[model samples]
Each structure stands twice: as structure tokens, then as C-alpha cells.
Target: MGFTDFFSDVWDTFSHPSPDADAGGKASTNTPSSGTDEESGDEKDVNKDDAKDGEDSEQGHKPSGDDDEAEEEEEEETVDPKDELEEECRNSQGCAQPKHHFDECQERVTGQIESDGKAKEDCVEEFFHLAHCVTSCAAPKLFAQLK
Candidate 1:
């Protein structure tokens, strides 16, 4: 593929997510139940275990008050690194979009490149800088890909 296509694909990977990832790379909870759920048998076994273990003591069972704190810990544990990074990048891009639009708005931006008594190399440099500036405003990570 050409440079532009490759660059676009890279940006897409960052903005969206890799299909190979299962919900932020977490293992799916698809338990294969041979289509026959033995709820009665399972409940009977669980009741026996609970009775044998006794209410106050079996193993590492945290109490209700401590469970509130544990729930908070579980919530923190569920954070997805990829999702966090992508959202952070998207927020930065959102903040930059309007400014980038102003910097690279069509009429003004074109005039910026061709007009003025700027040399060809200078004009090209300025154009690239303009492009970079605009992308940085909306998507700084995308701007980095161009370099």
C-alpha cells in the first residue's frame, strides 16, 4: 500500500480497536453448557457445601462492610489499558479539532501555502507544517504518524 493508506490504517488501529481483542483483551465468559443445565443438582451441591462450611467461617469470605470496599477494588481492577489510552487520545483530539479547523480551513490554508512570495521548498515546508498543525489539533497521535 502507499504511504497515505498505511498511515490511515495505523490511525484507524488507534482510534478503533483490534478485532483480535475480546473486550479489551479480557477472556470471554462463554461457558459451554452442553445445552442441559442441571440447576437442581448444582443448587443441592452448593447448599451442602454452605452448610458444611458453616455461616461464619468457611474460607476467605469477606463481610458486607468489607465487601463495599472490595467492590470498589474490583471496579478499579476492571480498567482496560487500551480503552483508557484511546479515550485519552480522543479527548485530546476533540479539544484540538476546532483549532485545527481554524488553522487548516480550506480557503485560508490554501492561500497560506501558495500565496505570499514564499519559495517552493519553503511553501512545501509550510504546507506540511500546516497539515501537521491541523492534525495535531484534532489528533496529535495522527500528526505523529505523518512524521
Candidate 2:
């Protein structure tokens, strides 16, 4: 990746709001907010048009009636990572496999030292090993062949 792409990704990680928050990064439902106001206005317009057409024709159309349902479905399909992160934060969890793998690696290495009665004091070396594990696991496809 280029420098710009790297920086942008880093920036987005810190800048975006988390998803698991109760508000879902949206304005509060109780507030007479501009965002909901706009949505309501659009829905009202569609409803009015549908009502007019239905009255004029023998066949009736439900305009805004189905729009809300469709939007709900779309929202369910497209989840934001920030939202997921927020949810994980709330639940005291991290992204799954990598965190577990990191803990496993530390435990396995320490266990070996204990079995051998060897004192482990190489902090710098351990840092590099863990760092490699993290970055490699982050992009498994790129590192798969090396495995």
C-alpha cells in the first residue's frame, strides 16, 4: 500500500465512531433532530404521492409503507466495522482469532521456558516475535504461502 492509503486507514480507525453504541452513531431518537426530520419529510412526500395515485386509480399503492421495511433490511446487511468495534468494546471483547492467537503464542513460549528451567529475559526479541505474529495474522492471505 502507498503512504496515503496507510495514513488514511490509520486515520479512519481513530476517527470513525464505534457501531456498538446504543445510538448507533446516530442522533438520539427522542430529539427532534434534523436527520430524522429529513427522513420523515421524504417519507411524507412518498406517502402523499402514493395516496394520491391510489385514490385516482382502482389499484392502490403503498409507497412509504414498504420503504421503511426495505431500508431496515439494507441496514442489517451493511454493517460498519467501527460499529462492530464499539460493540466488542461494550462486551469486553476484541477482534477474535488474532487476540486469542497472540495469547496462545505467549503462553506456549513461556511454558517451554518453564519446562526447560530457562529464564526468559529477552524483551526486545519477544516484542518482535509478537509484532510479527500480529501483522502476519492481520493479512493471512499475503503471508499464507510463507507459512
Candidate 3:
């Protein structure tokens, strides 16, 4: 099945769960009666034809490989701009000093915790300093891109 259909089925299964859902969370395979014997036989014939055509008869749809690949490519190509900007700013020269300070503080705090079974001080302040620097550097670029 296609992605949206799969998700829709999942949502339906959760939101309107069957009474016969087992303790293991699996719903019972017994489908409710829909029609008479002749109608069921007609449906079976259609299902057999669909199976011969290499289509997913149960889902009532077949996904093309090209469409699936194109969708995946588009998803992969669309990176969140804010995340990209933040990563760039963090690695930039303007934020390097604060990042280095945060790194050193983190190492010192971790070492103290390992040796003394507790840390005398945390790296929160240094981390905030680094965060502030990166945010300041990224904000202008991010806004520029938005404009």
C-alpha cells in the first residue's frame, strides 16, 4: 500500500480498534460478513485477476515504482532551513570560541563525575553561552533567507 493509505489504516486500527484485539495487540483475522455467497465468489474472481496482474488486491491499489522513488527523493531533498542555518552557525568562526568553552566545561564536568561519583558543577552556563552565540549568528542568516 501507499504511505498515506498505510498511515490511514494504522490510524483506523488504533482509533476504532476491534473488540477481538488479543492481549498481544493483534486484531483477529476474522473479517465481518459483507455479502452473500455469490457476491463473495465474484469478489474472489476479481482478487484472483488482481493477483495475476501483480497488484495488491487487498489494499485496492498498486503503487508505481517511479512515483515512490520520486516521493522519497523529494522528501530527502527538503532539508529544514532553520536546522541547516543552525548547523552552519555552530561550526562558523563566530561561535567557535563559545563552542570550545562549552566542550571543555562538559569534559571537566564529566571527568569530575567519573572520579568523585558526583559533579561539583554542571556545564549549563557554558552550554547556554554556546547556544546564545550560535543563535545570534544564525538568526540574521535565517531571517535573510526568509526575506
Q: Tens-digit lDDT track for model 3 on 9-123?
A: 9999789756755667754445434453434556789978878876533465676789898888788556789888999999999999999999898899889989999999988
* Model 3 worst lDDT run, 10 consecutive residues: 30-39
What lDDT would candidate 3 get against the real structure? 0.82
Best by lDDT: 3
Question: lDDT of model 3 at residue 33?
Answer: 45
Prediction 1 TM-score vs. true: 0.20
- CA lDDT of each candidate? 0.58, 0.59, 0.82
lDDT per residue (tens digit) for residues 1-147 in model 1 = 999999999898799866666776666456334455534666779988888888767667766798698778888555644444445544565445544544455556557567874433323444455445444554545445547
Residue 24 lDDT in model 2?
A: 48
Q: Which 10-residue span in candidate 2 carries the lowest summed lDDT?
A: 86-95
**Model 1: CA > 4 A from native:** 1-36, 39-47, 58-147
Candidate 1 residue pairs in backbone clash: 96-137
TM-score attained by model 3: 0.50
TM-score of each: 0.20, 0.20, 0.50
Residue 98, model 1, lDDT: 41
lDDT of 2 by residue, 14-115 (tens): 997777555545556643555444446667799889889878776646566788888787885655444444344333333444445556667876887889
Clashing pairs in 2: 19-82, 19-83
Candidate 1 clash figure, as a count: 1
